[model samples]
Structures are given as C-alpha cells and as structure tokens.
Target chain A: MKLFTKYNRINLSVMAVVFVLSGIAYYLLISNLFIHELDESLNDYKDKLHVFIKQHNELPRFEFFEDIVVTYEPVNVALKKKFVLVSRFNAEEQKESTYRQLTFTEKIGDTYYAFNIAKPVEGTKTLTKTIAATTLVLLLAIVSGSVVLNRIILKKLWKPFYTTLEELGHFKLSRGYVPVFATAGIEEFSFLNRTLSGVMREANNDYRILKEFTENAAHELQTPLAIIRSKLDLVIQEEGLTDSQGLALKSAYTSINRLAKLNQSLLLLTKIENRQFAAVQAIDLEAALKEKLVQFEDFWNAKGITVTADLTATALKANTELVDILLNNMLANAALHTQQGGSVMIRLCPGMLRISNTAVSGSLDNTRLFHRFYKKAAHSQSNGLGLSIIKQICDVQGIGITYRFESGFHHFDLQWPV
Target chain B: MKLLIIEDEKDLSDSIRQYLALEQYTCEVAYEFESALDKICLNEYACIILDITLPNGSGLEILKELKRQGKEDGVLIVSARNSPDDKIVGLNLGADDYLSKPFHLPELGARVAAIIRRKSFSGQNQIVIDHLTLDIRDKTLKNNEEAVPLTRKEYELLLYFVSNKNRVVTKEAIVTHLWGDDVDMADNYDFIYSHIKNLRRKLAEAGCPEYIKAVYGMGYKFSIPS
Candidate 1:
C-alpha cells in the first residue's frame, strides 16, 4: 500500500512543474525591464549630443568623443548627415569633425538625424550560474510548500472516513454498536459509510435472532426424541411380540437412530459455525487415533472387517473435542463403507492421515462426498455427516481433506501442518 | 455388583436398569443432580454410569462430588453429548471410562466389564493356564519354578489370547489389540500365523503341550483343555 502511494514522488513532480513555471515568468519580466532601461540610457546619451550640436549651430567636432566615447560613433554619423543637408545654405569651410557612426541602421535625416547603436554584450557565465542556483532554491521551496498543502488537504478529505474506520475497529460484540458521524462536503464518502453501517446493523439483528432460535430448538427437541427412543425400547422388552412386529419396531428404531445421528451432526455444525468451540489444547494425534481404533475394534470384528492402522506417534495443535469428532467421523465412515471381508487401512504420517477402505460400490461421485446428507446408495446407514464433520474441523483448524475413489478403494486424505 | 446410573431421561434410565437386572447387576437410578450427589455420598458402588446434562446441574458436577468424597475409583460417563470435551473432562476427573448415548447395550456392558476389571485387579498381574503360571509384571512364564521361553509377539499374543479366553475374539479385534494401531500394510493374517506357530513351538519345547490354539479364520484362543 505504501509503495503504491509514492507520496514523495507525487510531491516532487508537482513541485518541479510549479518551480519551472515561476522561474520562466520571473526571467521574462526581468529581461523585459533590462531592455527598457537600456533603451532609455541610449536615448539620453543621443539627446545630450543633439543639444550640444544645436548650441554651436555648426558641424560636429571629434572633441565630443572626450565626453561620450560609447556613443561617439553613432552621433558623429548623424551630425555629418545634418551638415551636408544644411551646407546647401552656407557651404561652410567643412563639417564639424565626424565623431561616430551607427552600423545597425542608415541615417536618413540631416539636422534631426537618427543613429542606432548595438554593443556586443559578453561574459554571461556568472549570470547563468546565478539563475541556475535561484531556480534550484525555488524548486526546494515549492516541494516543501506542496507537502504542507497536501497535508492539510488530505487531513480534511480523509477525516470522516478515518473516524468511521476507527470506530468500527474498536466495536465489540457486547455492545454491537458502531458510531456514526456526518462526512464533511463529500457526498460519496458519506454514502459509503451510511451503507456500511446499515448492513452491520442488520447483520447483528439477524444473528441475535437466529442464535436464540437454534438454542431453543436444540433444548426443546432433545428430550422428546430421547423419550420416543426409550419408549420404543420399553415396548420391545415388555412382552412377547410376533417376529413381523418386532421387525417393524426394529426398522422404526433404525430410522430414529439415523435421526439422532443427523441431529448430532447438524448441532455440531451449528456449534462450529457459531464459534462455540472455545476449547484449545495440544492434542496427541497418534494417541487419540489409537484410542479410537481400540474403541472401534469390536464394530469391525463383528462384521469380519480387517483393519490395518499405521498410526505413528505424532502430536497436533488442535482442540481435543474437534479432533475426536474429525477422527471418529472418518473411522466410522470407513467402517460403514468397507465390505465384511475387505480391508480398511489407516496411515497416519506427519501432518497427514490417509484412510482408505475397499470400495463396495464400483465408483462414486467423489465431488459431493463431504456435502451434508451425501450417502452411497448401497450403504444406507450413513447419516451423511461423517465427511462434513471432518470438513468443519478443516474450516476451523486450516486442515485440508480430499476424497477419491480409485482402484476399488475409497480414500480420504487429510492434510495439515506437521 | 451394585451400580449407580445418573441419567436425565426417565425411560432411558428405566430401560438401562431393566437390562442390567437381566444381566444380574443390582442398579440404582438418580435422574437429577441433587439426587445423584445424595446417592454418591450414601453408597459404595462397584461402578457408576453417568450422563452429562441434568435439570439441577451437570453430571460433571456429580463426578466432582464423587472425586471430593474420594470414591470415584470406578465410573463410566454415559452421555448423549458424546463430544470429546465431555469425555476427556469426565475421564480426567477420575472416571474409569466413557460411553456415548444411543450406544449398543452390549457395548455398555463391555465398558462396564472393562472398568470393573481395571478397578478390581489393576489388569491381570498374574494368570494361570494349565500348569503354566504367568507373572505379567515380570514378563515371566513358569510351570511351578521351571521358566518357559517365548518370542516377543508370542508373549503378547499369549497374554491377549488368554485374557480373552473362551470368547470367540475375531481377527480384527486381535489385530487391533495385539498390534496397537501400527500395521496398516498387512494384507493378510500370515503375521498372526507365524507368531502363533513360534509361540506353540516354544511352549512345546518347554516340556509343555500347546495351549494356544487357532479357531481357523476367526482368531487364536488360549485355554486349558477339559
């Protein structure tokens, strides 16, 4: 961001343009004045010579060079021309000594003749150096002036925006309130801030309402479900029932069990989304997996499934609860998907776990595998939240999980930091 | 053995009590927190089944009560809130183990049995099978002062096989229990076969006939012949 701003570059460029322009204007004004002064000095010198000639009412003399040597040549030329024109009346002995001549122009008149002189002005090196020095100094002044000016302008321009940002930065969940102040003379900024505050207010209101609903729903519905399952069990145990009736009750029990798992997964998803997993701990990944494997031995054994695990001794930075959920979900999914005589392999390396089971179905749409309510048509007991639970952990802990059905095997590969 | 059940739902508790009576373990129920606290203070139980949430307070509070009274030597926390937070909290508070709600009744029974063994015997320090007396602590097997030799996996397989004697332990259970989550590359049960063959060989060489027998595609079993 700071690189993009390039404040110094902008300031220097503006200052350079302003300084160059002012120097040009100053140079033009001073040069014009110098030319005007030179014209007046030359005019005075010419006038003095003209009066001197008129007083004697005679031709010019060379002795005039003693007083005004710089103008002698041009004045002498003018006086000689006047003598030639006046000599027609008195063919005087000779014209006054021709003093000077003008090479810039030709004299046309006699008594009132005109001469224009131009001297070669040289050695302007010092003048050029002085101008260069002054220009540099002016450039510096302009740069400093622009910086100061921009400071004032930017402060006023960004004031209300900064104020709003500061207030939002300090906003807390307890108050859920953001301070609003009117923007000064900026329609766009005021409109942007107004829209932001409006959205924040609405989001907070909706969040509070939804949070209350989830909590109420979880609390209210839990007991009734427990009651229904328990009543079903009691009915089964109470008296002798026909086999068909028993099968019907067992099917009902199975659906209830599925519903219960669904409820748990949904509740867990909500809790994770709500940021309610407040616990943190350094979890022993290998030890936790080993424990879960130990617990699941019977589940696999009863179905004649073979489990081969290579769980190494590595630790992870995770909350124990979420870690348990992630591992249990994966293990359960593997156990549910694999065939009775098939092999389920779990390999835990540093920061990665690959769980692969023999695929019962030929191929699967691996894409939507982690989505909620996803289930293989053959394995119907899946409540469809196993991979999704792992996903929730992935989202919260920055872990990554990928699934693939390849070469008659279903593989779930989870990766995280070592 | 007498057990105490601390659960929230009444019907669930009743069903659990009925099941335990069928299993021949005397049981008591405390559906509320205060009643649970009262029960823990009053009686000495072999095992306590606990639930996390209750109307009066949390089952975790009762667990603390048991700990304070210095009587929470054996307990299993049975909870619908099967989150690992509740499990670790319960276990660290001196619970013998934990089981989640909607669990199979047999699983609950298994946890109860494991906990009772842990609280009762501290896990098989010594065992007897036929003429062999195995001291688990010293890792020694003797037939009344004559030491028996066994390989590493053989000894482990022996201990596990005997521990689950008579029960038809499945191949997966043996693999998990014996291997301890280490062999994901094993494609078959050939490893178990070699270990069993070696164990049987060493036992027969020690002037004793084979006590470890294979039940064929199932699992190995250790028993004294009738």
Candidate 2:
C-alpha cells in the first residue's frame, strides 16, 4: 500500500464510526424532546379541564378541539394523573395516529369521574428519519472528497521526496555521477537532500583516494623489481664456476619472475574492480577465441597436446581487451593442467561455451578453484590468479562461469546470455 | 651512438648505462630535471632515454621543451607507469617509443637501436653484420647475397641478437624479449631452446659462418671471432 492510502484509511474509518454513533444519539434525543413537549401540552389541557369542571360543575364538550381528545368515565375510586403513549383513531382523516395521552380522576360531587387528554405527535418520526438520512449523506461525501483530495494534493506535496529517491537510485560510484539535488521547499526534504549530498561527496572522495593508492603502489613496486630483474640478468650472464651456483641463480630468477607476474596480476585485478576499461563494442567472439588459441599453439605444441575447436560464428558485446584476457587465461589454465599428449576441446554454441581438457590428476579442488593464489599441488606454472581473473571478468560482464570434472575430463562452462 | 639517461632512480640508470655500454654506445646520465634540461640545451645526443617521473619536474615538460627547441633527438619513455593514458600522452608529445618498467635489457637495447636507426636517417635500409645482412625495412634476412627463409619469431630473435651482438643474452632474457611479459620464463624455456636450435640449423644450411655461439651454462653469445 502507498503511504498516503495507508494513513488516510485509518483516519477515515475512525471518523466513520464516530459520525454513526453521534448520529444515532442525535436522533434519539430529538425524538424524545418532541414526545416530551406533546406530553406537557396534554397535561396543561387536563389542568384546564379540571378548572373548567370546578367552575361549571360539568365536563366540557369534546367537539370544540382538534387533534386533542378529552374523555370522561365514572369510577368508584379516584386515581392520580399519568401520561402514556397510545395509538388513537382520527375521525377526520379516518386513520390511526400516535399520540401522548394524560389520564386522571376528578370528583365534582358524590360521583367520581376519570378524565383523559391526548395530543398527536407524528412529526417526531419524520424529523428523526430525515436527520438520519442527512447524516449518512454527509459522512459519505466527506470520505470520497478527502480520497480525491489526497490523491492530488499529497502527490504534489511529496514531489521532492520522490525526485530525490529517483536520483539516489541511479547514482553510480564508478562513473562518479553525483546527483545535484534541487532545493526542496519543505524543511524535512531539504534536510534529507543536504545530508545525502554530503555523504555522497565523502564516498566519492574516499573511492578516488583508494584507487590512486593502488595505482601508485603498483608503480612504486615495479621500479625496484625492475632493478632486481636487471641485476639478476647481469649476474646470471657472468662466467659460472660450479653447478650449484647456476641452479641457485636459476631458482632465484624464477622466483623473481613469479613475483613480477604476481604484482602485475594483482594490479590488473584492482584495475578491473575500479572499472578502468569501460569502452565496449561488438566483437566476434569466435574469431577472438580462435586467435587466442592460435597464439597458445606453440605452448601446447611443445607438450605434444592437440586442440579441437567447434566454434560457431557468434558475436557479443563487451570490452575487447577484457574478452581477450579472459580467453587467454582460460586457455592457458587448460593447457598448463593437461597431461602430455592430452587433447583440449572447445565447444561454442549460441548460448554456451565449454572448454574441456584431459587432467593429469583425478579432480581439482572445486571449492578453491576460483580463489586468488589457489593452485593444484602439481601445477607450478600458474601464478594461481588465472581463474580468479576469469571469475572477475564473468562478474563484470554478467556472464556465468562454472567448473566440473566428469568422465575423465575437466570441464569449464561459460554461459552467455541469450 | 650517443645517448642520455634522464632518470631518477640511480641503480636503474646505472644498470642501463652499463648494459648499453657493451653495445658501444656512449652514455651521459642526468638524475634530476634541471640537469636533464641543462644537458639537452647544451648537448646534441643521438637519443634520450626519458623517465616520466624525475626529481624536480615531470619528464613530459622536458619533452615539450625539446619539441619547442626543434631538437631531433629520439626520445624513448622508460617509466614505471603502465597506464594507456601515460603512453598516449607521451606519444602525442612526440616520443619515439614507450617501454614499461622491469624490462629486459636486451629488449631495451633493441628498442634503442631501432629508434636511433629510424631517427638518424642514415639513408641505408640494410644492416650488414658479417655476411648476414638484415633488410630492416623489409624484415628479411640475407646470408651471402642469398635469401634465408625465417618465421616471424625466429626472425625477431635473430634481429634482437644482432642488435645486441657480442653480448651474453640469457635464456630468461630471450624469453622475455621475444614473448612478452605475459609468458612465464621458467615454464617456456624449452620452446626458446628449440627455436634457437632451429635458427642455428637454418643459418648453417645457408652456408653462413656460426654467428650465434652458446656460452656454457650461461646464455647465447652472437659474435664472430675478431
């Protein structure tokens, strides 16, 4: 439910209950007042009859008054005056009408007489009925009018709040698109915009600083590494005396090479996370994959491994460099892990791409396959960031990547959106 | 050939100077921005190895100054930054080449030679190295006035060796120089060894003297006896 509807629903329901109860009370009070007035008039008429009888020592004629009835009856005992509501027959209209009647006993001489006076009161029922109907119409009119008014006026009143919400929804840190919130006339909305803009500016500043730190660290780390590599190059070229020294230098050189690669891979991961490469275009994925495989032909050929590809002509939209890196890392991982004389197979269809290779071991640790610096025990060639790079690419591109080992073959499946 | 090394790092500049000295290039060093500017204003060197980040100022300002003075010295940017924006900016400011940090010395020597050759306008397209003549413009090798068939990688490898001739080029350096930074050195030496063997055999079949000699337990040296 919308905020406006939810709040107004409760308000209107409470108002409806109160109006109904008050209407009922008003109807009862007004009807009782009308009946009480009729009773008072009838009592006054009885008193006049008693005065007339005392003056003339006889009862007055009943034909003299209209809508007022006076009746007399002989009784052995005297009774006090009392009023009651009774239905009486109308002689002129020839129908029954409700009236308030008063009865009492008055003694003129030795014989005792009972006198009755009555008055018609049909307007009270009509009055109560009209008031009840008007109350119902008034309640209904108020509810519907407020509903329409809320739909228009509340929408206008909350316009700034909705606009601010929309601006926040589209904000992106990577693109550095901060919203310029307009000044809201309402105090609360203006306060909200001011606070949110401050938070966004701070966030953007922190992000920029962090990104620069990563890039600077990479650059600083590379210079010393360059010196070490150059010195090692010079050392290994000198005239060697023994076998042990050559082996030690070779091992140290290998470690340095690995360190440089590790640094580069880590920097590349940071760049990917920072969204440094954002240019995108349509690319022939099959041709790109084929070119990468051809580039790796020599490495696989040295190990006597064969490659079989079944790539359909398909194009995708992505950053060209990212796609190339993704493919190169996948192919390198496959070639490095496969046994000698093993075969590598690639299958690409409309919505899927699969690369399966013959594994030297039974199965890889699936839990840690895509984690950084996670490698199989027997594989020393990989710096262990290949699959992690692949995972990051898939995440950035909104693709799906999975690994499965089945039927003596290790399979990697990449599913592209259809 | 004469060159100037405009860099902030002492050890890296010294190593570069030492390595290029073996190739018979005279070197001058400027470790700060002011010295670099002074040397460029006073001297006319064949090439200048410029680092983007110097002690006093940015190397880009120096590049702009060189262009303003109408100096024809070939500028090669050697920096630790690997961003495309830096490379693009340097190239737009008239740099001859851009090489990132931790580069192989042989590769550096090759780039320096190519830059010098291209900038000097020596009016010679062919480089004759003791009966193995390399047509630099056409990318072909001719031994004893006869053409020798070579693959792209083998040709590139031979040219690299010829550029840094008489120096011991390590196998690791060869891998890094031929294949790029992406290939691991320890994992692909067999491929390098095979390519070397194939290159040697092809040159021998062409009846050329042995130019590439394998130094025992070290690397390969490409030179003919004096």
Candidate 3:
C-alpha cells in the first residue's frame, strides 16, 4: 500500500479507539451529575414542607402528581432523611417509571409520621444520548478530512523528486547530456538531487577522458606503424637482397599488417561499447544482407565455396553502418572458416537471421569462441575479433546470438524483437 | 606536377616524398602547422597532402586556411585516426580523398596521381600508356583505337598498374591497392595473380604490347618494351 494510506489508516484507527473509550466515560460522568442534581432538588422540597408545617401547626395536606408524589408512612419505617432512586407504577401513565425519592420523619399531631417525596428522571437519559451522537459525527468528519488533506499536500511536496527521477532515467554518459534537476522545496529531497547531479557529472567526465585516451592511443599507434611499413616498402625495392632478408622483410610486413588490423578492431570495439554511433533507424535487414552477400560473392567464389541464401524479408531499427559491419564480419567469418568446395548457408526469417557453414575441423570451443584474441589455433588467419564484434553488437541491440554445431556444420543464429 | 606534404611525422613524410619523387612530381615537405600554412600562402600546387594531427596546430586549420584563401589545390587527408567524423568533415571542407594510416606506398601514389589528374586534366579523360589507352570517364580500355572489354576489377587493376607504371608492385601492394582495408593480409595472394592474368590476356588479345612482366618471385612490372 502507499505510505500515505498506511499513515492515514493507523491515525484513524487510534482516533476511533480513543473516541469510543471517551464516549463511554462521558456517559458515566454525565449520568452521575444528573442524579446528583435530582437529589438536591428533592432535599429542597422536603425543607419547604417542614417550614409550612411549622407555620400551620398541623399535618400538610398532600397532592398526587404524575412526575412527583408525596406520601406519609409510620415513623418506625423511616429513621432519617435520605434520598433513593426507585421504580414505581403510576396510575395515570400505567407503566413503571424511575424516580428519585426523599424520606424523612416529621411530627404530625401526637404520633410520629414518615413523609416521602418523589420526582421522575427521564430528561437525563435523553440529554446523554444527544451528546454521544454529536461527538461521534464530529470525530468522523475530522478524521476523514485530515486524511484527504494530507494526501494532497504530500503529492505536491514530492513533485520535484519525481521529476528528477524521470530525468535521471533518460540520462546517458556516452551522449554527455546531463540531467537538469529541479529544486525541491524540502531540504532532504533537494540535497539528494544535488548529490546525484554531482555524482553523474563526475562519472561523465571520467568516461569522456577515458574515451579520448582510447582514440588517441589508437591514432598514436598507427602513425609509427605506417612509418615502418613505408620504410619497409623502400627496403624491398633495393637491389640484390638475399633470400633470408626477403623472408625476414616479408614476415615483418605481415606482422605489421596484423598489428594494424588488431588496433583498428580494438578501436572499433571500444567505440561500440561507448555508443559512439547512436543514430539508429529502421532498416531492411534482408536487403542489407543481400548487398553484403554480393560483396563477398567473389571472395567465396575465389575459394571455390558455394553460398546458398534463403532470405525472408526482415526489418529492424539499428545503426546502418554498424549493420553493414556486422554483416560483413559474419560473412567474412563464414567464408574464412569453410574449406575449399564447402558450402555456406544463410537464412532470414521474422525477427531472426541464421548463418551456417561447413567447418574443416571439429566443433570449436564454445566458451572461448567470442573472447578477444581467442583464435581456434595459433597463426590462424582470423584476427579473432570478428565474433567479439558480433557479440558487442548483439548486446547493444538487445539481440540474442547462439552458436551450435549440427549435421557437421557450424551454425550461428541471431534473434531480436521486431 | 607539384605537391606539398604537410605531415608531422618526418619519416613518413620522407618516405612519401621518396615514393612520389619517382613519378617526376616536385614535392615539398612541411613538418609543422606554421610551415604548412606558410607554404600554402606562398605557393600554388596541384595537390596538398594533409595530416590532421600536428605538433603546433591541427591540420584541419591548414585545410580551413586553404579554403579561406580560395586556393583550389586538391587536398587529400591522411590521418591515423580513421574516424568517420574526420572523413566527413574533411570531405565537406573540399578535401578530395581520405586515406587511413599504414596504407601501402604504391596505393598512396595511385591516389595522388588520380587527384592530380582530376584537378589538372579538365577535359582530358584518357591516360595513354604506349599503345594501351584507358578512358577514365567511361572506365574502358582501348588499344590501337579498338575497344577492349574489361570487368570492373580488371579496369581498377589496370588503373593501379598504370598509376605506378614501371614500379615493382608486390602482391601485398596490389591487394591493398585494389581492396583498401578489406582483404585480410595473411590470406593467399592468388586473387591478385588471377586478376593480373586476366588483364594481361585481355591486353594481348587487343594486340597491345607486352607491357606487364612478372619479375621472378617479386611481382609484376608494367612498362614499354625496352
């Protein structure tokens, strides 16, 4: 449940318990006060009767009434003046009624006589009922009103927090767009916003510095390698070189070329991880695959490998250049791994693309296949980065890539949401 | 033809100067930004070879200055940073071509020659190599005024060999020149041998002179009969 609802429920429950307990206490106190007031009035009426009897020197004639009654009895039955509540039947009303009675001994002529005075107490009960009902209605109104008012106030207070949270969700370090946090009126929420903005700023700065270092390292490394390659080009043109020298130069040349390729691949992988290429659009994947296949037709034909394509139209949102690179690397890998006269197969379906080729050797080690520089064997023709690049692309696009060996052919399958 | 080399690396600039020296083009070297800018202000050349990164300032500044002065000299950007942003920006600033680093020297020579041709030879679209004449605009080859049919790859190969006419072109150089950063260097060079064979056969069928010769185990050399 929401915090506001929880707080309101607890608050109202406590108030309800207190209100009920106080209502019972109030009923007892008010009823006792009414009974005390009735006793005082009965005592005053008895005193007035004594004063009248003294003035007349005879027993006062008594009158019968509906709510009050005066009666005389023998002196031995009543010892002293006292008040008691009793229920009596009244001939006029024909029902039992509660009343306060005062009894006292008074001299009439020669023998002692007991006098009784009674008054009905029905108004006290009505007064208490009205008071209890009024208190309950007022309590209910206060509890519900405050709960609603609290909810509205809290929602307004938390508006800035929600805004900051939403902006933080959309922030990307690679894009270098920092979120602008709105000022929360409350102290703690504003402090939280400031701390988060500072943290993100530091993180973004670190990421940019690291990215520049990578690009600079790749650039710096290429210049010297180029100089070496150019000098080697001149050395190879010299007159009369021994076979060993030529072999040495050729080995160095090949190693330098491999180094350059490795650098470029590493740079490209870093850029992909950092999201340097963020522009994406809906592209026809089947058409892109066909174009790549055309580019590789000659390479495969030169190796006597046959390409079989089963294309079903597929479109996905992705960076076009990355898609081109992805397809090129995959096809090149397929061509490179297959033996002479081997066949390559490509299939495309809705939300999926599958490429399979005949492998000259047994199944490759699945664990190390996509690791950087994890070649199948030492001195293999591949730079060992093609599969790694594919893995990175799949991760960025939220695509799934699976590898399997079935029917003596190695298969790579890629699937994504349409 | 005249060219200015505005690269920060001395050894690379020296090698470029030496390679282009064989093409009979006058070459000047500027090792820093100030000197490169000075050279641009003082002289007019067929093309300017620019390096984006320099010690004193950026090579892009030289390109900007060249444009600001309205110098129509062809600019070919050579950068170690093979970023698309730089390529796009350079091309937008009127640079004719972009070549990534560690490129083969012969490939560089071919690009410079093509740039010079595009800039200097306005309506002259044909390159005459003895009896073998190549129509650059149509991408066709003609010998003794008779059309010789060639595939796209064959035509490109012919242009590369002709660009470095008599130089000994290695299989690695030919592959790098034709396939620009695409083909794996460790793979077999048989593709180059096949392409060269096709081009030679087509030339011979057209009654052209035997200009392309295989130099033992080295590579092929294209030249007039001696």
Candidate 4:
C-alpha cells in the first residue's frame, strides 16, 4: 500500500532468497574441500603402506594409528586403487559415522593382498555445521539491521513529500493565497514541488481573472439595464397608448427586471464566493428568523398559506449580510414553492433550522437542486438561482444545507456547527 | 428647488431630469467629474444626485469636496456597483442615501423627494396635496386635520404616491418599494392591486377625491381627477 512498505516487501524477499541460496552454496563448497583434504591424507597413508611393505616386507601394525583404520584381506584378484566412503558403527559413541576409505592392491613376493585405509570425518563435519550455523546467524543479523535502518532513513528522506501532501490538502482557490513549498534536497521531490507551484500559480491567476470578469460583466450590464428600464418607464407614461401596447410594455418591463435580477444574483454569488463579506459577529438566530418571518408574512397571507414557527434563541458567529441573504433566500424559496392554502412550518433549535412547506409536486431532484439554473418544471417562473444562492450563502457561512421531501412537504434543513 | 445630476450616462441623466422636471424641480446635468465639481462649487442646490463612477474620478471625491466646503446640500449617491462596500463608503462620506442602478425612476423620484423634503422642511416634514396632508415624521395621513388611520403598508404606499404625484408608477416599482427586490414576487401583482384598492377605499371614505387611477394596463397614477 505505502511506498515504503511495498519497497521493503520486494527488497527483503529478494535479499532473503539470495542469502539462503548463497548460504547453501557456501556450505556445499566447504564440505567438498573437507572431503578433498581427507582423500589426500588417505592417499598418503596408502603410499606409506607400500613403502613399509617394500622396506620391512610386512604390513604395518594398524593399532599404532589414531582415528585411522587399516585392514588387509586375502584376495583372488588384485583391486584397483580407489577412494570410497563407508559408514561404520563406533562402540564408544554408539553411532554410525562416515569415514573416507582408500582401497589398493599390494604385492609381496607374488602374494596379492587388498589394503583399505579409512579415516573418520566427524570433526570436519562438525566444523562445516558450525560455519553454516554462524553464516545463517550473520545473514539474519545483516538483513534485520538493514531493514530497520532503511525504514528510519526512508521515512526521514520522504519527510518533504509528506509535508507537500499536507499543504496541498489545505490549499484553497478562494483564499487566493499560494503556498510556497519548502525546498527539498531530493531531485525527484524538488521537481514535484516545482511542478505543483507552477500549477497553483496558474490556477490562482485564472481564478482571479474569472472573478474579475464576473464582477465586471455584472457591473457593466447594470448601466445599460438602467437605461433600458428608465426609457421603459418614460414610454409607459406616453399619452394615447392602447391596452395591447401597455401589455407589451409590461411584458418587456418584466423581462428586463428578470434580467436585472439574474445579473444581480450572479454578482452576489461571485461576491460570496470571493469572500467579500468577511465581517463576522455574533448574530441572534431567533431574532433574525423572526424578522425574516415578519417580512414574509405578507407573502404568506397573500397566498393563504398557514405559518407555524417554533424558535429557540441561538447565536452564530457569521457575517451579518450573508446570514440575512441566507435566511431571505430560504424563506423566499419556501414561500414561492408552496401552493395556495399550503402550510409552512419553521423550527429552530440551538444548532439546527428546518423550514418545510407543503408542495403539490413530489420530491425534487436533490442532486441537481443546488446547481444554478436547474429547475424542476420547465414552465416554472423562478430563475432557478434562489436555492443556489441560499446554498452559496450557507457554504460561505459554514452552514450545512440539505433538502428532502416527506409527507407531501418539501423540507430544507440547515445545520450550524457548535 | 434646484438639483444637480452628476452622472456619466447622458440617457440616464436625461431620463432622471425629465422625470423630476414634472415635479417643478429644475435639474442641471454634469457628465463628468471636473464639470460636476465646477458646478458644485459654483452653486447651492437642494439636492445632488451623484453617480459614484464618473469619467475623470469617483463621485466620492465630489462628496468629499462638498464636505470640505461645509455645504448643507442633500446628496444622493447612485452607482452601478450594487456592492455594499460602495454603499457603506458613500454613506460614511455623508451621502444622504445610496441607490443602486437599474432602479425604478419612481423609486429614484421618491428618494430624491425624501432627501429634498428632509433638507428643506427640517422638522416640519409634511406634504399637502389638496385636502390630504401626509405627516412624514409621524407617518400618518390627515384629511383636513381629521386623522385617517392607515395600515403600515397603506401609509407607505400613500407616501410613495404623494412623493411622485401625478406620475405613473408601475406595479413592479410598488412591489419592489414595499417588499424589496429580493422577495421573488415579480410574477404576481395581485397583492398590489388589493393594496391599491384598499388605499383608494380608505381615502374615499375620508372625503378625499378619487385620486388614484389605473393607467390602462400599465400601472397606477396618483393625481387629482380632472
């Protein structure tokens, strides 16, 4: 999963396999050398027997040697000189031990005899075992030491990378502040940081440009829209206008007003996103909600919608303007969507606010509800930015908003952090 | 009373001037900052409708100039920037009111009239139209010294009509004026019709002539019947 863990798994496994294979090869090489030495000594013993037989005309006494056994056997045919290994039982130790034995034929006055000389290899075998055990212990120690050292050093070496990751996690485009990465000594990490810095710089630049464009476009539209509206106001006052003309002017006026509102909504959204309303103070939620309710009282009455409120005094630290807009948009949304004679209910607790209104339609598409210009009905008169504006204000104010439909009522809930 | 409109847009300035001209107020126009400053220095006006963004400089500078001269003229700032920052800064600089652009001319007229009334009338803030007397301070209406009770919205609607008397005010303007533009009630003006009907009934009961007339399908015009 982690880079260090993945590298260590592959590195340690390969090292373990190589170490075991080399250890086995080392053991075999050492044992072969021991056998070769034993063979040489046995051959020398055979040569000595020949010399003794020629010099003394008799076989040397076998009891004079230690750890070597010599034997003679009458043979019908002469035996070729060769080396062989044999296992013999030892009376004292009560165990079978391997010996290197040399067999040869010797002639004394036309009599043929077979001679076998054998020597015990128990010490060499013990020596090989000791060397093998020591090698295994040393290999294990080296592997474990390298593993521990690699973990510590690698962790320290990748410290800059983790720091970069943490800083990236906290980066925000709305803050408009680019973070400077700490210089790293490693080339690969340095390159990564450099690339990231360039990307963030570009992103911040693009964001600034986009924000300015939105503000400027909205601002520029305002004057022209004002001129058009003023001209319309003058035109409506002209004498001898027919009712049809008045209707046309009214429709035009409505469209122009809608356009103006849309522009203003976009501007407000941009402002909220830019964090322009940064002044924060403790706002009494109960008082604010009550005030908003009073403002919407006329609309509710006009639509014949019954209103119910259960409010508790709660305080939140947020920008006053933002809170006002958030409350206004939410209440307006509820008032606009509810059918005539529908009931609107509001409940406010310490950290939660819920506003639900009876709706003829079923649940709205929650996924697309907060997206700008997303409307449930094609013929709905709403510009579809009201909920989005509410969502934006809630986001800026650190409030969580959710929408749901239950029991023929559309419910909007706002949660504030304690 | 004399007024000065310092705005860069000629069409908008002319429209405002034309609208207020019907109220018997003389309006002078300045299309740039330097000319506006020259005019402000040269004359005393009852009100100055200042646009914040001018060709040469900001209108706030003109406000500062007015404050430097210690003039007591009422100043109303208009800007296309609907940002609260400009509004706050403009008000802080002693502008009497701040109106964002794309405003209804009637709303502008009402604000300008309010500013002039506050500046000229001082504490004796009242407007008399025929037998109807609107007490601005107490927010009440009187017919020949007989107190006429009016609801809060009725009073406000009556005051708005009195401010822009004899001129057609659209239902949209009245809706925005009463409930603000953020209420999303643009498509429905039935409530406005009811309010107007009630106001007319109440005024007619108080021996006031039929003053409010529906101008075809356009809107309402408050004037003495000819």
Task: Name the best candidate (by TM-score).
Answer: 4
Summed over model 2, clashes come to 0
Q: Give the per-residue lDDT digits (tens) of candidate 1, residues B12-98.
A: 788677656655689999989888888889998888988888987998888888888788458888876656578878889888887
CAPRI band for model 4: medium
| DockQ preference between candidates 2 and 4, better one | 4
Q: Write the residue-wise lDDT of candidate 3 on B1-226 in tens digits.
A: 8899999899999999988887788999999999999999999989899999998898888999999999999989999877778898999988999998978888888898899999988899989878788999999988888999999989998899899877767777787776646434225667567778998999888888888887535567777897
TM-score of each: 0.56, 0.77, 0.69, 0.94
| Candidate 1 residue lDDT tens string, A213-329 | 765565455555666655564455434466777667666765665565566667677777666676787888888888888766655775578999998877778777678777877
Chain A (candidate 3) TM-score to true chain A: 0.66
Off by over 4 Å in 3: A1-214, B182-186, B215-218
Cα lDDT for residue A21, model 2? 94
Candidate 3 has a TM-score of: 0.69
**DockQ scores of the candidates:** 0.09, 0.40, 0.37, 0.67
The better candidate by TM-score, 1 or 3, is 3
Between candidates 1 and 4, name the one with more favorable TM-score: 4
The CAPRI-style docking tier of model 3 reads: acceptable
For residues A1-418, what per-residue lDDT tens digits would candidate 3 score against the true structure?
A: 9767888889898888888888888888888888898888888787888888778867776665434688877665436788888999766768888888888887766656788888887676687777678778978887878777777887788788778889988988866767889889789989999999999999999998887887778877898989998998777766577888877887887788788888888888887887767888998988998877766776787888899999999898888878777787888888888888999999999899999999888888899888988788897977888899888888787789999988889999999898
Backbone atom clashes (below 3 Å) for every candidate:
9, 0, 0, 0
- Candidate 1 segments whose C-alpha is farther than 4 A from its true place: A1-4, A58-112, A119-129, A140-222, A238-248, A266-325, A331-384, A391-418, B1-8, B17-77, B80-97, B102-226
Error of 1 at A243 (Å): 6.4
Maximum-DockQ candidate: 4
lDDT of each residue in A1-418, candidate 2, tens digit only: 9889797989799989988998998888888988888887787777887799899898767775466877788999999878888898977668898878888999887878987777777787688778888888988898888888887888988889999999999987755657999898999999999999999988988887887786678767999998988787666556653678777777777778778888788777777877767888888989898877767777788888899999998877788878888887888788888878999999988778899999887888889999988978746776888888889888788789999999889999998876
